[model samples]
Target chain A: MSLLSNSAVEKNMDLAPAPLKKEKVKMKKGLQLFLIALPFLILVFVFSYLPLYGWSYAFFNFRPGIPLSQSEFVGFQWFKSIISNPTQTAEVMRVMKNTLAISALGVITSVLPVTFAIFLTEIKASWYKRIVQVLTTLPNFISWVLVYSVAFAIFSTNNGLLNHVLTDLGIIDTGVNYLASDNHTWLSMCMWNVWKTLGWSAIMYLAAITNIDPELYEAAKVDGAGRFRRIWHITVPGLMSTYFVLLLLQIANFINNGMEQYYVFQNAINKDHIEVLDLYVYNIGMLGTNFSFATAISMLKSIVSVFLLFFANKMSKILRGESII
Target chain B: MAESILIKKKTKKEKENSRSTKGEIVFNFFNMAFFALITFICIFPFYYLFVNTISNNDLSSRGMVIFLPKGIHFTNYLQVLRLEGLGRAAIISLSRTLIGTILTVFGCALLGFIFTQKQMWGRKFWYRFVVITMYFNAGIIPWFIIMMNLKLTNNFLAYILPAVIQPFFVILVKTYIESIPAAIQESAELDGAGTMTVFFKIIMPLSKPILATITVFAAVNQWNSFIDTLFLMTDSKLYTLQFVLYRYMNQLSSLANIIRGSQGGSSISASIANMQTPTSVRMTVSMIIITPIILVYPIFQRFFVKGIIMGAVKG
Candidate 1:
């Protein structure tokens, strides 16, 4: 009878806290946690989600210093203007062409950092490697304004060192306005981007290389493979996943060639060629006072970018069975 | 016989490894020279700017100060230091960097810690809500309009507040904190420690490496950002050092006033006037803007490396 009573008490102890009291405690903890997180949620709402509401401005003739509600609502008029008007369409087409061209160039050259990483690892001296890495990564830290300053100091038409040296060497008779010239604008921009990002981008591949199993190299050596063979067989394949992931990300970000680089690099002469979608949006919105239209173009851009990101994630999952986000 | 053949093959491989082939030696020579040249290219521009700024103005403007300083003088730097509104802009930049970095690091750390709590309401939903923002950006116009609506335009808080809770940094901090053992927090909680107490007292003290990483990224971004000022601030009092330098770089008219003001007002020497050319002044100002970054970079660089690796793993 005592054993039976003890078993009954044990069952009561187990089952009693499983429903109401446990739920109350769980809810109390959740409430405390929610309170802790509420402020951050509010911040994210303001900065990120809030701007999304501003996408509504694309449909309105938004005037500065005027309340949005007081403004006249134009239903898809700005978006329709982009499609219906000839000159506007032509300008946008040009901007789109430039954007695709620049992004395509970057995609083609994305192999460079992988090559840089492989070669960088081949160097015997670690100190020399570290110094090269540090110095090459330096440009990534400085602002594009400073980069432009360096570009201007080196390539300015009048007092540029390029012209000065070229003329002195009889390579050219006078200074050429390289900065202002429209020739190879996209290529030059891509080259500048490569210069800025090569070392910085290589860091990821380097990290991947360290993650490669040392046993692979040992087995390759045991099999009488040479250094280049080892790199080709072991290291390159090991880094493939990392490279593909980065490439997928770049594809997702294809249109977001940020405005800053192109903005600082652009000049009156190269405006036709150098103006990308982001820069064009900035030019129209801020420089030309066409806020509604810029907002419209950007709304489309954001939609496309989100779509591309999901597409990329889909591809990542299909190919690698893993997702980036 | 098979074992002997394997031994022979191993020795041959060992020999090949000990002595690189002739082709590889040639390739290595070129590779080293090529990378060395690249290193030179990376550093030469700054060095050129430096030599030009310090050299005689006539020579630098004439493109004579190529490799080294021809006439060494601190007059250009002195003139730049005395430029109108320079000190005020420097102060604004410094304050923003300090305040922006601190707020962002703290916000990211705290939010990151909060998200890791299993009891947090709507944990998965909220995490996705924040992380999804990283993939798409509201275009500059919308962003600008929002800031305007928020009355952040031309306000100092515009710099500090928008950046306080960077989503990417939040993700980094969250990932780092997740890697830490959860048992420690459980123990502390058993002792009646609150969430904030666990975060501040236990989690934070253990997460210094990641905190440092976030600090470097935040500080550099704040110091280098000029687009916000370019779009939002019309007030010269709110101009940052980088923005001012940008104006001086792009608009010669804006720079002319400062150069003329410096040369015309003071009882300066003839040589000092010769040293304050437009190119010299521009280069000097660029130097001024970049010096702080270069100063702090070496110390914070390892943290960034760790940060990048962490990001790579998470990605």
Candidate 2:
């Protein structure tokens, strides 16, 4: 027993030096990886975080050519102008109304994609389903510029196809300016959005459907449930969690109706109802050249969006017992 | 008892055949028709544009070419392609897509792999630092200001550099790498492979699927982006095809004038010149811009679906 203990003690004494050496080698390797990772970190810092420093421009009357240090410090004066001044207040309110109205329409119509997905799975013919999916999803791949061009070709006053058909049918004496008309601009925009994203968003729900247990369908079938009942009880219940999660995300992004779509579609006539917050910022910043005021508005938007995201996260945690983030 | 059980089974079968089959048939017909209509709506615009651009411009401009081509000619595409600065813009767009995609894929793959290593210094903190950027943006003005301050205005690097470290792609790649069996990496380490060596030799090959996914994403984004060009490129040389198409759409008269100016030297007849209407020019330009997407998107589409599934599952 003493000999065996001595042998074990000797083995430990010999191996005690090895881990320290391995630690040194491991530390060196980590340093090498850190060196390699440093450039990407710097790139992220420059592009992502570095812009946060420019948010300070809101406090200054920043000019294009002049340095911020030389610009006058306004100290929330631009933010004050958004409320304290009547004309500015009206403009902000109008922009907010446009933004909120468009977003609300978006949220309300969000269920259509879910419905589309449910019905899409009901199609028995696989080839037809694939074709529908491929074609419907194609528009999402193209840029908004191309979509606008498509809109133009189909709706232009002089050479629109809709007008050509309508005139041939004697539906009207003249062509309606569908693209430029301010009437139902919100609804039309929503329709255009639905046309673009319905298939793409349905893909998420479809994926979620695949995750549902096939055994549930089997059990429901054994219980003599009808096809519609099975879909209602099994598939829909399975998809609600995904739907609610995506809906929460949509709500979190309530204010960020992206600029590209609205930017390309907006014109002099439709600008009143079509301009959302992001587009408004771009217009004032780039076209109006109100950099300081634009900065202030966008700063507020970013803060509100982040707060909304956290609020949604909290809601998700409280209700679903999961952290979305 | 056996006879009564047999009768009950027959009745249930009859009920299924008599009632459910008819209702399901009707439901299926409408469902198929509805989807067929949607498919047609989705496909018809591209067909309309193609027909218009290829048709005789006089008839097309008069709204005569609705469902089909009237006088087939490719002159609008020819003339639009011959426009000044278009060839350069195409080259610029192509180069940006290639280089930017490669850079982004490499950056994402490397960062993702390193982040999975337990030995990575401050791996959790660094990963969070990168991933958190996905949630909040500093807004457009500040971003534009920073780009200008960095001298990215009128510079091509403006497109390539800012896109390299997309936090969303990084997270996607990190999740994917985590799913790869760590035993393989450990085996590579046992073979005396260094970090860079192991990454190049083993991890990259194993990661082709996810990397392919990100490649499609990065390439599509690079090809479709025009807002960046609109903001940063005051220089005409750096304009992408999409942005140039946008310019033509907004300024149809000037575009028509330019086409006429370009075609004056050709011995074409007055009728041919008349065929190059502003509307035709715009439609042709739009077609040209979308052709690549139309051709490539279907081939790489499954990768995108895969990416969406990955994101959904991880979330």
Candidate 3:
């Protein structure tokens, strides 16, 4: 036992010098990394984390140019106000409905086109596939403002392309006011959203499809399966994982219909169908200068989005044995 | 062995039932129709925009041209170029996108490298900190407040600074960095190279594909962005291309007034006269705004696909 202890001491003494050197090197590396990360840490704290404290402003009647501590805090006052006010409450619900409807339409229209594009890329004609891919994706780069303008050109009552073509062909006696009609507004918004997004969304699925093994297709061919049969059996099953992942991620943003596209397209004529939650927040916060109420709504949105994300992640695990979060 | 025998029997039965003539015909017919329909819907808008841009203003005004050009006219393009704010707005937008993208990519890359180092203390804490920011933000109002407090409201810094270090870009860069092999770092350390030296010399070079992808993504995002300008920029002089185009879209009728005035027509009363809305002009403006970005897209598309696929698979 004494002999073993003497050898252990000798070994410890021999190894101590190298470990000390390693510790010094690690400390140096840590210091350098901290220095490098200092600015980012400061930025995250100031911009992201600090404003989280401002969630407290939802309880207060927040005003600019006043210290937050000095502001009067009335617990749940904004939430109570939102609930008690019938007109405001109706507007909120209306906007929420509009947001969901638009997003649902967008998701439905986008999914098939995206899936088709991914499948189409697997076709034999390489050049044709490339052209189709390029042409399809070109629109994704175009801004919503541009898309709205194109829609305006086509659907304008006075001089729109559709009105002109219909009138020229003697199909209609009068021009159609497509933009002003509330019934058509939501559909128009959905069409525009799908047009801008379908190709971009397809890119993700296309990447997923490319990752699929080519040997599966050969095996299906050897079984004397036709193209459509093979696509149904093989291509779709291959894309299932990616489809689920993207679908879950997208569902997490169910409440966040884009603000800019809606805001730009929205007119008083189409306000009923187009005033989504993001725009509602923008109008109330930026335009109306109702800072506290807007903050309260924003806080509510954050909570809801977080819950949705968690729920979606959990559901993904339940359904697919994988979750993004 | 029993399951394999059953599977083989099932395959033989399926093969005997497959390859029906009616099924092939029906499949071909529907496939062709669906393909044509999808392609038409996707491609028609670009054709519409192109035809409208080149068609004579009068033909467009009369709503004569729909699918094809009545007469090719470059006059609108010339007129757009001659517009007062066009050149300046283009320049402002171009410079802002270029500068903004460069700063954002480098900053995110540097931060990503630092965060990925295993020796860094509290690395997990910082990673969580950044990721949490991705999920929750104080909304645009508080961000605007921060910008105001920093006195960045109207200056170009307002546009650039707020967007310089996006949480998404940082995450993407970190993911890309993590995929790089650790052996390179070990060699650099043996050479007595510091973290910065290793990052700039070894790590960044290996990350060219991702860096290029980030550049394109950031550039396109910055170029297409108008909301930032809407909130931060009060000055018309500082307007980006998209914002300027939006202004024209909102005030489209004013272009007709300018054109009519140039044509020596009777001065139309501002309130009563129904001015031509320049529907084609709006289309032309849209094209003008997006043309630069579209022209540059193919260069980035290659990097974008590779980088995203690699990142997604690795993640």
Candidate 4:
């Protein structure tokens, strides 16, 4: 890392000064660059690092409208409470269960997007391919709230189209409350997630496919290889590096299941199955205005996530000979 | 890179020259069928939403309008368009997207240009300063407290400020600017142009494709973001369109559940019918929310695709 940063510094500047004035000119350039970079630097410090400083609230009995300096400093109390109290432990466990279930489903289905991209590339008709690509990618740009609306429209008990079609075909006597049911929470979330992000994620793989060395395909063709053979031997291997990079990043983010989609999809009946680690923090923090306690758990999650990220970065470096960080 | 692409095109044309064997024909048939199924699955929900939103109210309520529209009615959209606070919510959403995208794209472009300039002292430190934020944060509760402490709550600046410092985007913009020949900027500098002048007068014009790409990303992010509004905005006057939709959906569903619990059976449908937002209008709300994106996505898609590939592969 030190070597890379040093080389970066050397490569960035075009000017090479004589030894007599090297330090003076370098200092002048550094000052100029620092001025140019200052505004964004301060913005990032306030937004990113300041919140990290706020994590100190984990050690206090923080209350709103009361300054942290005035609050009682109780080191390890909130962290212990996450495990010592039965209710807190159960809540934390339940949140962890949902988080793991959803993430596992997400990781399992990651292959679908890659497969989708491969199949998409094989389409002979250009117009149909374009239409499909555009339509599929549209949902990715919409909010989770809008996606929930579509989900409810298709899966709502009394008026959902899925239930309507099923009933009309004599599949059932009445509508199935799939949206309200907690039995398939993991399955439903995975399906919705795939439906929403498949096209957007597939674009990465498609771009990778477009970047494959064409000589390999041409040579394979000359060797009497079929399309499937070319795809399996060449295209798939070309995509593996990209796939593994993304997959490692995903693993690093295993505990960071974002709250928005699950937040919108949540109902009273399904809340038990829907709430993940981040949502639980939001819920508990807002539930009784227990800021410090919630921050403690949030702090723990953030630490674990960072540790996982570094571990994953190391693994990728060792295994793939490439490091993301 | 251009030559490689040209080679790929020629090779593809060469491959198309040969007659397809029977096995290849079968494979193509299956491939088409698979993709057709996948495409239908992707597009069906929006089609269903649009048809049902335009269908007759009673049939839709009874879950009968499955395949197509029973009656084409524009009333739902008209009513939704006229809903109270909707115009205000839309103004909030629009202004935020516009202002946020402009600031973010500009900041990123400027910082991106700066990062690539070796003459800038400590450029690596400044570049990594923001990218680290992309992977690490204090998580939700502490971040919320920080936002609260900063007094960004219920403030318009809350919506517009944070986006301007997006590190990933700055990195993306920097990668793109780096692709432009160094001589262009070097020559400008030699001509006595300052860094600011070179960035605004030269780099900005040449980086239009990438700027457009990041603009779309920032705009979409700003437009679709609701979690910020949900957490930060206590004042209804500050609500964005998506936040309003969320509250409305929760309200309707909870109200429907209460009426169903009390009245039961067919009367449940009656109470739901009496609700402020009907099924058709709810679907219309979904359509309203996504229509702008759907309308302009194709025009901006090439840039989006270009940006993603450029950033992802290079990163």
lDDT agreement with native, every candidate: 0.88, 0.89, 0.75, 0.83
Give the best candidate by lDDT: 2
- Of the two candidates 1 and 2, the one with more favorable lDDT, higher being better, is 2
lDDT by residue for model 1 (B1-315), tens: 999999999999778666777767888888888889988998899989888888888888888898878868877777787788887899999999999999899988998998898887898898888887777778788888889889998899999988988888989999999998776776666557888899999999999999999999999999999889988999999999988888887888767878788777576564743656667778998998888888888787788899999888887
- Candidates sorted by lDDT, descending order? 2, 1, 4, 3
Q: Top TM-score: which candidate number?
A: 2
User: TM-scores of all models?
Assistant: 0.93, 0.95, 0.86, 0.88
User: How many Å off is the CA of A293 in candidate 4?
Assistant: 1.7
lDDT string for model 1 (A83-115, tens) is: 899999999999999999999999999999999
DockQ winner between candidates 2 and 4: 2
Ranking by TM-score: 2, 1, 4, 3
Error of 3 at B287 (Å): 1.5
Question: What is the Cα-based lDDT of residue A21 in candidate 1?
Answer: 80
**For each model, chain A TM-score?**
0.91, 0.93, 0.87, 0.88
Best-matching candidate per DockQ: 2
lDDT (Cα, tens digit) per residue for candidate 3, span A1-325 = 4554555556546657688787997888788798888886787787776666667778887776786678898889889888899987898889888989887886677567656765576455576666666666667777777776777777878877788888889999999878777886667788877767666667777877777899998999888777778878887888888777777877888888768888788787888888888888888887887878888888888789889889988998899887676
Q: Identify the CAPRI category of the predicted complex in candidate 3.
A: acceptable
TM-score of 1: 0.93
Off by over 4 Å in 1: A1-26, A65-67, B1-21, B267-273
